[model samples]
Target: MTRPAHIAHLADPDDDPFGPEASDRYFNRELSWLAFNRRVLEEACNPAHPLLERLRFLSISGSNLDEFFMVRVAGLKGQQLKEVDRRSADGLTAGQQLGAITEEADALMASQQAVWGDLRNALDEARLHVLRRDEVDAEATEWLETHFREQIFPILTPQALDPAHPFPFIPNKGLSVIFDLVRRSDKEPVRELVMLPVSAARFVRIPGEPARYVTIESILKRFAPLLFPGYEIGGAAAFRVLRDSDMEIDEEAEDLVRYFANAIKRRRRGRVIRLELETGMPEALAAVLKSELGKTDAIITESGNLLGIGDLDTIVDENRPDLKFPPYVPRFPERIREFGGDCFAAIRAKDIIVHHPYESFDVVLEYLKQAAIDPDVIAIKQTLYRAGKQPAVINALIAAAEAGKSVTAVVELRARFDEEQNIYWASALERAGVQVVYGFLEWKTHAKVSMVVRREGGKFRTYCHFGTGNYHPVTARIYTDLSFFTADARIGRDAAQLFNYVTGYVEPVDIAKVSLSPRDLRSDLLALIDTEIANVRAGLPGGVWAKMNSLVDPAIIDKLYEASGAGVEVELIIRGICCLRPGVPGMSENIRVKSVIGRFLEHSRIFAFGNGAALPNDGARVFISSADWMPRNFDRRVEYMLPIENPTVHDQVLDQVMVANLIDTEQSWELEPDGRYVRDEPGDKPFNLHRYFMINPSLSGRGAAIGASDAVPTLSLRRRR
Candidate 1:
């Protein structure tokens, strides 16, 4: 192949496929992400949602903001400190972006606090009040006092900030309370700090009929004077700090695992990125905190109530199902049920595409388990990006390896936030004799693939499983993803080739059925966009439909804008941040953008191009990918986008997943050029895509397969007016 076209910056004038007008309407990527998070925080106040679910949304917002601070904010801070003046695609300098981000973050935090207040009141109405230490009844207080002395006081370490005693280390994201203390004999005031134990619960549920509660911090604050007996009681204010948690590893180091362990330890003491203080905190106390933490006034924020609301997740107990969404158990595909749950037999019968959450992940577990025990199976190769505490997938891989099967497991060591767990799995896999390769040092291997090389009848054959999500079963239960199981020779060969490239760096010359990143994924996509533009200019029935977690690559967005301007209808189903502004008068008149937010997370990446023809195979191009349209995926990661050539699978992805997301109004938000996400209100005939998916079986369902035939449903194509 001609050394593929050089990758150009998204904002370069030469790459502006969509004329000048389209560029003007595009929103800044960073700002659009902040807007997406605002929507998440907004969900906490949504009256239509259940109270517990709303609380869960609040926790998600907090966790999301923490990640945003650690990565995005820290990255900007680094760039600014290095005096790098490179502007973002939207033309904003690092300092400018930081200023805008701080303003937006403040507003988001304000909204979060407001929603928390609303949720607290709503929880109170439900007879579950989170009481303060002073508000606790006399009996509850006495019990708590005894409980604290037994459970907490032993772990407490209070340090005074004085010449004699140095200020202790304040860990990242750790909560502490600053107070004024006066000695009995000297009659002089002193400042002190108290660190909250990480392992302890943030809220202590009072023993009562109605279930009142008190914060652990509040209890600690009330009992601080007791810990220091000769000191007079003084005013105290609680605060928390966010730090740069992103890890930096040296590839040249001899011991990768030990280096990471040390890095993890250092992460706890990372430079503070943000400092949150309790509302109405005295200026003196706030100033003391700033000086000690070495943070500027710009980094300080004040909020009402709980500083770390993610702790609310503990309160959303499984015991309270009545206060949450009705628990819906996933159903096994009737085809599997028809075969007495023989995964191998079912998958071998025909290529199948399974939609998760609606369908049970038990089937995936079954596949691996069967392969682990099957005498016919000779070897297995798998790529693991993220897995929960106890992954059945990992167990299956270990079992297969121990059972004398040749298993090669490529586990990415740099899965951000899950690095520690990956390290643990690496050790376990290594112990089991599984060839565990921690991918390339420079790139993160993110493609989700599993291959089982088996002997069938007379010859060795490859059975491949390509997915748009991680192997983590817990996330599979909530994140919307697609899984493709196939016996196609070309696809199997392609998958095997990819494993080779990642493990041994021998890029296959004939990779027709898929596009792998860090090699060809970006250029492949750009060429596809260019082809779509060609068909549009040729006056063919051209259109583009894509769904991903985010869209920040400026070049791709510009191309899509050009396609739209050239009379190609563009429809997008972005679940999170989207920088490309749609529906502007002259810029994106032909483009329409909608975001889907509901009970489950929309995570599958689907791209479709109408190649001047009809439906399935009628010049229609479809692909399922493990990458979002982000710059990192394009440049710094090993990702893949596999074409869905099998007509049945293509129809299921396009006709079902793509179309449903496009029309979903209840959970959909429309994006404006001005970085505003306006929720599509309840109209006369409000259609909720999530509710529909819950009740309506997908096109690949057993019933649909038995009834519907070779004719695949083509989604109604809408075009620019």
Candidate 2:
């Protein structure tokens, strides 16, 4: 009957329970993200993981931090420069956040370097050696010199740092070695810079029995003499710089593609936000760098070994299968298999949900591939946020156009970091006679939806596919996502309306099944949470469970805190950047938050509400979503939330996917009241959801082979192998 303590304090209202201890109410968004990266880094140090897999984890952490600096940190720095002294939810100002983030990030970078050093030993133990010049044998040195002359020396360009040469421009995330060079006769030291060729391999492989390689930085240091002709090589230190990469585009631009292309060029010249120098560099050389780059000490980082650990991925040997995760073959849904891979017939049987990584994304491609070639199909529509390197999806769309069927693709040119790929896709799609439309400049069409109109018995019918991840084949192998296929008339109509809304700016009204954000998705979410609270107040079983990538929207957190206080159990699985403070006594004690980090990325968004019954109880409410509980998703982007009304689909999402995530103990980390994460211990009985999914198939996809059950089927560590 009364407002929850947290909800009563929007904007930290006076006398609000949430405002009294503002610092205790939520975690700082920037720091929360860094913590997630820490979790990823932990996997690199985890000996349980394969050697190359550990390196992969370390590489991922490095890349994650790089983006954090480029976007989040860069934005915060901009705010600081503009004197925007506003406090985040955790009561930290822009400057304060930067100060704190720098501390955390510095420690994380150190940990990464340490792990890489130890991992190098693990690699050598496995006979995959990463050798330094000193470690290389005389024979290996001769071989290196020969290879250096042929492969590397040809590309070296030395720039003298004198009045005539001035300092050369280094690209963002660019690697270069600073030299204190001296002329033989003058005996005066002259500073110089040698940019590492970006086109060359990061590590030069040495020809040997036990695979060996030397980092390019090491090779540069060893061969600096050869490149510098008469000048003697003095002191050298390798350094790298990371610059602001977040793009700013004019919303009113006539051509989105042209604007993005030009903006990307400007992004390369943005202000430098972070710098890394090898530890123990000459103070004189460091001073020259400081003056040349005009950066403060706050942005400077010292590397223990090699700079840019993310580049470690380049050395991941594909031949060394024993040093990586066992290759997994995704299961093709039996229903589709039985239907001779005809996605339409399988969907016609009933609504189908395919859990990805475990279940192949080929089913999604099957729908598009079939539509492109099928004689009955007359129209194909889809939204692409990130197409990745997969030629299959785009090829299918192009084939549909070549077949003379009407094909439309609403490409979001603003998909961060994928802007270039999308630009190319847009151009290619247009050249193929497909209708290409860039969605509203104000809102990115982040929702992934596809519809195929086919002629059957003189009537046109639409088949739909909704996914929580990109159309990226590479990501599908590592990101755990969902793909739902259905021939249901209501959903198809809703899909058609959505496609129209995105491509044609037609504000959809009277939508039947799906909820769209920036319009009604948030309202629908609030109403669902309210239902759970009301159910609890009415003395019925009530609860709320949501799994998403983030939870930064204050309104959503307030509602969650409301539900938690009203005796509605709340469990959240937010993989990154959760702002809500869970398990805070007197505020959100009933809310429990957990993050899962494992072999696969937890990306699929699923929600469940008791709806006046216990969770997953006979007919509890269930839904799949392409949006997280974040402000950008709710207010600035196009997103979708689809209700799971079909019996089998509901069971599959709630009883299977959601349940497994909740029960996973092996890869889960619990969030505490103080914002610290504690990894769950198996205690002799570990349950790994990833392993479970890899070994087993989804119940809904089993088709007639599974026995019918009255109760929703559940699987747990104890219940299933």
Candidate 3:
């Protein structure tokens, strides 16, 4: 699990000018995010990845770009509509950003199409084919005809476009085919529309072949003439409409549930932001469609591939295991096994940190389930931000409430794209007698902290869990996150206070071990950065290293710039948007930024600062947090940052986890000061962080006897401060 020595060759931060309007001072966050997606697309292009896995990355890139437009680009469009002249911290006006985003998005799509073309050819060779209508064999054509007449025609509804019939409303992310039909009687051409079914499978599996399939759009287009019997079909085009899906909830509403429910309804009819069309669409028809849809800022992108390739997930069959990453079973920590599956008994001995996708998340599920069944457990409190459709955590909470143990769940109703799901869960929880509390209207409860009050030996003892990700079981299998279980009195006390603050609206006091955002986390992070600056002044080899999903807070960026100016070495592993420009001489010469995009998503957050010594020294302070260095995370969301105290857990995170990411060569992308990312060139020894975590057992998760196996990462650098 060791990484090759490569960090020493990267350009040192000491290489620039401190300026307010320097060309290389800051990178545009929007452009930076697009760069991250490009890296994901590169994985799809990489020859080393399995064929289906490459398709998965391409599909993910498509889905990610859709979200970016629906939210980030939509926000920008709104600002431009309102004539707000405000510019981003990177100095681009809203209008300028929209233009830049469109250009980058187009380039990304072009790259995706090229990669997809390669994948399509490879899939053909692998016996799985995405057949165009003309390419379908005679045997398949018979099955497809019957499939369309029986399966599709029954559900198909074609709307005639004329003066009497207004263009029918299309839902968000809906794909449709617009057609020009000529009436045989009048010898006049008429405009018609056929909206694709939303619930239908995106790809229809051909019966003879195992993996061969045809897109729903292709099927619709082939049988479209059957949809119009009275007229001769002239020109037809397949297009997709992307509407603004951002929900706007009123903060002053009396009933939070009702407000959110209504907002979800309104979200369906949101303004159209983008329209995607197939290449070779008629220019006259495109103009007509644009005029009918009254959105002045509607973005139009014409593609040669399928309209919505994100739906390719439907055909990525699980039957072909060899076409994906080799399945790795998650290790249910030996620490829990040592206590015979009793989480409480295991936590009593020592704290444990579980890295997900490699280490199991079932432990978190079992911990909650055990609390629900344990008579000694009296009260349970938890916060859920983005629990998926079949979250086991919600089930455990409901069971506990039904069992009569006092249960309170703070559910964030504004988790974007998950509002409808969260609202339903909130109602279900309330029906089951679990006290459902919608957190602050102005701020989202984004923290992942759960607390249990247990009656241990006639005295109440509290157990707490902190996480860098959500409590969703499905996401746990793919997203790399952290789950920390602790019995420490101070952490438990802090957890209880934080929950009380959210549910009771009481300001917490005497909570010192962990930092909470929207109150003081920003200042605390600044203080850590300042400590690095102070260390450099004291003749110490000061350094700062942080890994998070994004870094966009202007003030925090300024603090890091100052730390860099003071000669403290700084390195950031930002998986997504990064506003700060590293390697800028004079201002940020001592700073570098790199992003990791690969098999497993990098979602965990870790911040380690050299108080007065080099990074990885025993004295260096390390903290794991649910918050990213973003303004919204700090100012508009509830978040938590936990300082790693246990010697084993600390080394496991800083030495093993952070070091693995910092040295990744296969899928790493280093961002230059000029707002471009250069992929790391493979050396003689190629190291992939995802593969490293796959084969290695965690330190704290492994118990005393069998935990010392060769698969466990060796602890050679354990220096405690």
Candidate 4:
């Protein structure tokens, strides 16, 4: 529990003479996140990706923006409304940040529309048409009218917007159409609103050879006469609402489950944060809609053409392999396959690291399944941050529990957007007799670890699995993560202590190998950086390489700045929201930062330090983590950072995984000191890390299958000396 000496000076502006003004030393976290989304949007314009894949990127960008507004922007709006006197790490007030966010988000929304327009045209040219009303032919029109009457009309309820009716509540992200109409009998002007059913598909596919689709709004407009038999339709416009979706848990609530269930219900009706209107909406109509929604302070944008662009993912799901990236089949780790699929046997032989997306996630599942059915396994412990709708992991734990083995599942109910699923899993686990422990109400248990204790030779031996991603199988296929399996007694003991700490609130006194957050993770990381500085001062080669999803903690940024000042070479591969301003002449010239956004998300957390020698050597200190370099991760969540001690596994992670990311050019972006990201250009030799991993087997995964003639080619560092 050693705190860095400079921790006290980090908040003082006058501590470092070489650094810029305290406010100017880092980029705004919110703005940096927007930049990352912009990069995701850029991939939609990248020709290297197949047509459908590019469209998928556009859909992902839209979804990312929605979440950003729901969580990040909603938090700031709350602060602004409460008049709280808090400033961001970069010194922007809540109101100031919102103003800047509005400007940037408006531009981003416009770009998304522009990209969608282009992709729409490309999709049409590829014989996949998203047709306009005018483009619908006679045969398709006849079928669509019939299809709408049968499939969509029954779910529709039109509410007259008159003095007799109060404004109806619009659910979060709900899309609805407002129509100007005239009653045929009295010729009276009237207004009606129809809420689009969330159960209906956003795009209705018309039966045809080319696979044409029409928007549900288009169908509603086309068949307005069918629904309102006595009214003449006039000018109509569509609008979508985005409400505050963040949940606040009542600290004093007697029942935790009841609290979350009520919170989920309340989130749908939370204050409206954004209103997106399709262009050409009459000014009076827009004013009325905004006033009804109580959106005077909400962000209002005239979204062109498409309202909920995230729905474009439906079209991206068309079964046209030609318009998508070639399908890839993941390989099961040879080390486990070599042991006849016995996970414990392979781990007992040696530590193994499985590179996910390239190496199949089935190996992780197999490990759990084996533990569930094995007669020798007497106990199972797991942590669940996000177990998807169809959770095989939960099933395995249930099976073990039903078999009378002691099973403990730490289900975190505050995983944001996945809370409901976690709740369902917790109930199911408890019904199956599994001991379900909801971790600390204040701190989320974000670490991904599973351990099994087996009776062997009249003693218990623990086998552990530590991962940098969720237990969700769907994401495991596309997210680049590491699954480390080990039987080392030190790490096993630490894993048990971690479980004990979360389940029983027993603070670990002397953890041997791994560091836990809300305890000593931050201080330990700072000490590691300080070690590199000491190495440099003693005339030894000093280096550090780290990768994670974000780097927003000010204290950590200051520590890295201190390392850079002491002549330590620091290379960071931060995938998103990096506030650290690298390449600053006197402040951070020795530090370099880059982000990789490509076919697979870079999700693994790794840190390597040169322990008095050059990096990528056997002596370097390498570790894998479940936490990012963010304030909430270090101080507000229960997380773990474990060392890579086995020689082979250490070499595989440091040399292969870390080295490939550092050298990637096609999908990498270098961050400038001024907050802009410049995409790395492939000069002479273009190396794509995703493609390399997809083609080459990882070193540790190859196991005894690796012959002398098939020695894995080594990846070397581009030395900076």
**Winning model by TM-score:** 4
TM-score for predicted model 1 compared with the true structure:
0.94
lDDT of 3 by residue, 52-100 (tens): 9999988988899888888888889989999997777655667867887
Per-residue lDDT of 1-721 in model 1, one digit per residue for the tens?
1110111123445444444344364566676788788888877777778888999999888888888988888888878878996777656567767887887888888888888888888888887788854577778878888878888899888887888987777777788888888889898998888898888888888775687778888888777766778988677899998888888768687776788778888888778888889998888888888787755323778866689877778777725666798888887776666677777677777788888878877778888999999999999999999977776998999999989999999988788888899999989999999999877777899999999988999998888889999999999999999888887888889999999998998877799697998888888988888887898788777778999999988778888878878887888989898878777666577888888888899999999988787543465899999999988899889899998877777877888778778777678888765556789875765666666666766544645422222222348665412
Q: Which residue pairs does candidate 3 place in steric collision?
A: 13-589, 13-590, 14-589, 16-585, 16-586, 17-585, 618-719
How much is 125 displaced in model 4, in angstroms?
0.8
> In model 4, which range of ten residues has the least summed lDDT?
1-10
Question: What TM-score, over all chains together, does every model reach?
Answer: 0.94, 0.95, 0.94, 0.96
Write down the TM-score for model 3.
0.94
- Residue-level lDDT of model 4, residues 1-721, one tens digit each, is 1111212223344433323354567677888899999999999999999999999999999999999998999999999999998878766678877888888899999999999999999999999999976899899989999998999999999999999998899999999999999999999999899999899999999875789999999899899999999999987889999999998877788888889988999999899899999988998789888888755488888989899888899999999999999999999998987899889999999999999989888888899999999999999999999989877888899999988899999999999999899999999999999999998989999999999999999999999999999998999999999999999889999999999999999989779999999899999999999999998999887888999999999999999999999998899999999989888888888999999999999999999988876545648899999999999999989999999988888888987888889888889999877777899997766778888887777555553322332233453334431
Reference-based lDDT, each prediction: 0.80, 0.85, 0.83, 0.88
Give model 3's clash tally. 7
Greater TM-score among 2 and 4 belongs to 4
Taking every candidate in turn, the Cα RMSD to the unseen true structure, in Å, is 5.0, 4.1, 5.2, 4.5
Residue 34 C-alpha lDDT in model 3: 90
